[model samples]
Target: MNETTLPPDDFHCGYVALIGAPNAGKSTLMNALLGAKISIVTAKPQTTRKRVLGFYTGDTHQIIFIDTPGLIRPKYILQQSMVTAAHSAIAEADAICVLIDGARALERGDLLPVGLLDLLRKAGSPVFAVITKSDLVADKKQLLPMMARLLEFYDFKAVIPISAPEGQGLDGLIDELRAVLPVGPQLYPEDMLSDAPERFFVSEIIREKIFEQYRQEVPYATEVFIAEFREEEKCDHIAAEIIVERESQKRILIGSGGDALKAIGIAARKDIEAFLGRKVFLELHVRVRDGWRDNEAWVRRLGY
Candidate 1:
């Protein structure tokens, strides 16, 4: 057995859950902090389905970030699971980062985070209000009122504004989040990036590409599963299946002359090879699972 080395005395370990509305840049912030792409991202919002852990090890602290699915009003059985997963992290985490769109907060009166504040009222964890995408705005001062509103009704440890894509305010975010953790030994190996298995990531990579390549409800209704992943001497052999709720959706994914499926495979292979640091031979199959998202048994099997 391979023994693991523990960190020296005075090390800190804690879980910080990132919670917010769709498109609030939680995954981007997580990837930026870890300095690696532990969570797959796309232009689409609500792309993350499960709780993805990104571990950051520093000199004195290790922050285990829970990149959760975006909080939304549950409309379907699948969405109910997503919202449940987001709220469940509140109890497990020592701190919470409520990321909000600075511009959206100002224009819409920050209703989403305000509604979610109820979940953290008795959480007993330090919550931080992080305003993302400040680089795109000219008036940074507009964020103050939003911060003020959050502070008025919520118990936030700090209010920080950051732009993950532009590499701004991340140091302060990391430092403050790390400061709240309790002193303990290292929770994981120093070299590990995420707690999820490689198969989970393989599925996520395929799902991310599906989100990018498809439009409208297709991305929302689709799910990807890696049925097989085997590493050979020369390359990794991965077989994945895309499941949709209807047969019509399957046709859209396969496309005319199978061009769309071919494109998805090409794009996913490139990313899988980059992520694994080895060549990957990826094969995809399409299946019609009628009402999978709505059925409790099917949703459970899909890992939602």
Candidate 2:
């Protein structure tokens, strides 16, 4: 008797890295593409501190979108490392998406320090210049000059404008991505959305909550470390410590009667539960790291 076997999964897979300046909505774009909050988004510069991977699967394509930290000047060691991570993503990607906020234009003082055009030229990757926040800019006339100026930077393989918030031009962006993806086996399973482990997600969730609650430099000065994560059938309990520079900052983070900490915990737990699809018990604590952001050792230990 002859038996017929199923055909192999001939999926198109490739890595596409998103690079942009701070507050360029790269995280929002990634979340929108994945149809989930795979990466946290807030109305603050430098909200994302590490490289986040988001997966997009279609009938015949699996595009792994790497959401990197917004590029900026490196004032601290941590910031330098974050910038390095973004550049590494650019080098490793099968394709590159250079995201620019449409509402903002390059000015005399405003510049992308790494010389993105040159970097792209060196990497030799097919780059898509994506102007995000299309919904904000109403008049196309206002954007035309900006687009033209962008063209002067480099000859992009494709230039597309998208509103990640309103989900505009996403299909076209996806189609453009599909056209550029090399034919290969799937890099990740259809069900997987990120390359990070649960512990990393736990820390990020807590950090996101902290960013939402704090103002000024508090959020920027803060880092979340998952000291311990214990999983139970009933609940996945996480013990995380928020590292800060000074005792005053620590007090502020803790808040009166731990109200601020409670707020952060409550918010983080809710997001964590949604992310893991299970109950989450979150414990938060504040510690003084004495300018840990500039400390290379601390940055590595915190997994910058």
Candidate 3:
């Protein structure tokens, strides 16, 4: 192995799970910390349905951040799997960061779900409370009460306020997390950002566009699968399938004269090319799977 791949003597490396409500900024924080977009982000809730691993390699430590799906009461097989993934990350992580939307907490006066608190209490690893979207809080003084409230519920290793968009309090968050990590060799190469394959991200990119392009149930009902990815001499060839639960949803996706599908394709192709750093020929096909979210077999087949 080369020098970059070899771990330093005092390197600290461990997994830190980021768990929170949907759209609470877990993916945003991970993307900011890694300086790359490994997890997809959208304005809609439950945008992330799987655990995304992002590697933040510093000279002294490599923090493997597990960006998990939002914590929720599952009503279907797919949601159950998503919650399971989040819980599994908590059990396996060296540390856990529970992110709460600062503005939303101020509005609702709730810091966390009772079940989530119970899970953290039982978790063997150290837990930290992170207040995301700090910039959205117009009155900075309100953060004090929110932080105090979180401390009353659990003995968080640290309570930090951060805004991923403005680059606020990120360095301090990193320092605190790094300090808690166990001293060991780097788990991944220094230059590596994530362990997930390229196809996963390519599919995610297409899914993100779907979420952005559609509203309400359409985005939630949709799932993208990359069936073919072949690297060519001058470009790459990719074929993807977009799965929906009903024919009406598929029709909505395709639109009149296939205009909507074409629009989604055009938008997704641009991002795919940018992410892959090569020209791409992306083909998308919509198919109805009939209540796949509630079917355990279909959920597993979709890699949920």
Candidate 4:
């Protein structure tokens, strides 16, 4: 059935926003929860620059999880847009899961950012303190004091520790989230994983490959735009342009004899084909956009 079709009378549905700092595993958690990778994850901070929605449909509930950009003070137009997308998610959510990197918080001895805490206070939604990457913690005993420290800041609906990769605490987290959802019909089809189109995910797949292959500022400076997507009987033809800020970065991305760009293309094409479940003829190009990150129009045009 489609999204418009009504579900069983006892079904529950609502939006849940997964909010956290950069590298806090928000994307990982969403991918884990949905059992699909709608959002890209990388070691780099701010890998997610916009809101990605994943639909988790169960017999009893449908949780629409909004994976947001990491919360950070914006220094430029693009960053400002990222922060805005996160804020917008917070406002739209019925519940908010504040993901705290378990290992990182334990090392720093801080639970929540002062600014983020203040923002959550006014969010008008049930806030959940989710300690992510529990598998990384050497001493599980340390979590008690961490949870205590977290409570000292704000009253959380629940404090849950989870390792997304191990499937630890995922069931409990789902139960907690499902319990808060309002009784309603499904907002999306049970078979539908996400509302984002194929083209958007295609661009994201290419961008993720860039993030994986490049180092330092190259990945952050680069943005992928799908210039052409054509469906043929045998395979899909896709052409993408990687936008960078400077010619030097372009030279670096292309490398001597165009080796680097070719490597990215090869890796990206494999994943893209797997994602689409079809053969793909992929094309890649690099262009200099000169301070595109700071330019408001450029940032908006790039689909940030």
Candidate 5:
């Protein structure tokens, strides 16, 4: 590791779960802290579906970072599972990171963090608040009130203001995390990066591209599933299915002469290659699976 990313002590190690409302930049923060893209990120809310683990190894400590789904009230069985997974991380974690967007302010967004903090306090978990996107908003004065907003419900061990995308206040956040880490042996190997398999990441890459290219409910209704993964002597080949609910959504995804699908494939292929550090042949198929999100059994089968 470089001097800039160095951890405080060689002997500190612990599980720090990243918890927050939707689109609070937790995944971006985890990727930045680890100095790698261990978690996938997108503009849409609830981009993360499970407890993705990103292992960051320092000279002495290995921080097992858990990237959780954004906390929201469940409207369907899949959403309920997501919310459960989010809370499970908080319950099991040695330390908790409640991330929020500093530039957006607190009032405009959903206050799910308020309820989440109550659960954390009741469980006696040490909590820290990280206000993300600090670089977007110029007024530093808003930070005090933002911190106060969080403090009103529950006392945090530390409150860090950061722009995860711009890399602001990351040092302070890491320093605070290091101080809270318990003395223990590294949980994962030094070279090991993430717990998610290649297939899972492939699906996420496609989904991220959908979120980037599509608008509104189209992104929310879509889910990517890997149908085939094969390796040739020359290159790695992958076939993935993009599931949507309606035929109209299918038309939008495929576009004229399959242009839209091609764009998503190209973008996703680039990311897949970078993640695998090898040449990749990405093929995408868009299909309509009506009401898949609302169906509990289908959601579980799709690995959501």
Candidate 6:
């Protein structure tokens, strides 16, 4: 009798890192690709400060998308950590997707993602390009020039143009991604969406509500921490501390007669309820942590 050799499995699995400049819609792209809001989104730049993984399973491939903070020049220690988180993801990813703002690139006549090609080259990961927020582009002809300029960035495998919110080019984006992934076993189960702790997103949801509540300097000065997250039979109880660097900002967060805090708590509680699929009783408080963003100790303590 002759010995028989078995063929290797053809199933694919890999990490895909989304890299871009501030507010370039990397989070939006990840949510769209997963068909779920695993990554938070906001108008504020650098809203994402950590690495979040969104897992997706298809017929033959399982892709783990790593949503990292938008890469930026770090003026503060917090921002340095944020940029570091994004860079770390790229180093571990098997494929790198460079997301660029189509509107901004068209307006400036410059493709901002070209700088990322150097990092991608250094990582030795196969890179592709995507022009995000395509729906915002009024003139169709404008995209041609933007896409043409991306050639200067590198000879990308495929440069896709996508509108994440409007459901355009998403399937094609997935197909493009599937081609670059490695043949391996799925790392996560099919039913799982993310690997982050519940408190991480609880803090993030509260942080999002803060951004929605304030403007200008307030958002930049604010961060949230979930001091206690407890579960009851009928409802979840969450207490979040809003951290600011100044007493004046703390007063601004609390509002006169505590009315502003009430509003923020109300909005955040509703979002948290929806997110957890349970009734939530949320508590909010404000504290002053001077220059927390510049202090690595507080930055790590605050869960960044």
CA-lDDT, candidates in order? 0.87, 0.85, 0.92, 0.91, 0.85, 0.86
lDDT of each residue in 220-298, candidate 4, tens digit only: 8989999999999999999999999999999999999999999999988998998999999999989999999999889
User: Which pairs of residues collide in model 3?
Assistant: none
2 against 6, candidate with superior TM-score:
6
TM-score of 3: 0.97
Ranking by lDDT: 3, 4, 1, 6, 2, 5
Q: Please provide TM-scores, in order, for all candidate models, with all chains considered together.
A: 0.95, 0.93, 0.97, 0.97, 0.92, 0.95
Model 2: CA > 4 A from native: 1-10, 106-114
Q: What residue runs in model 4 are displaced by over 4 Å at the alpha carbon?
A: 1-9
Best by lDDT: 3
After superposition on all CA atoms, what RMSD does each candidate show versus the true structure?
A: 2.0, 3.1, 1.6, 1.4, 4.0, 3.5
Provide the lowest-lDDT 10-residue window in model 6: 1-10
* Clashing pairs counted in every model: 0, 0, 0, 0, 1, 0
Model 1: number of clashes? 0
Candidate 6's TM-score: 0.95
lDDT of 3 by residue, 78-183 (tens): 9999999999999899999999999999998878965998788778799999999999999999899889888999999999999999999899989999999998
Error in Å for residue 257 of model 6: 1.9
Q: Model 5: per-residue lDDT, tens digit, 180-294?
A: 8897766677899888889988888888889999889789888899999998888899999999999999999999999998999999999999988889998888889889989
Which tens-of-lDDT digit does each residue in 83-166 have in candidate 6? 889888989999988888998887776566445667787899888888999999988788987787787768788888999989
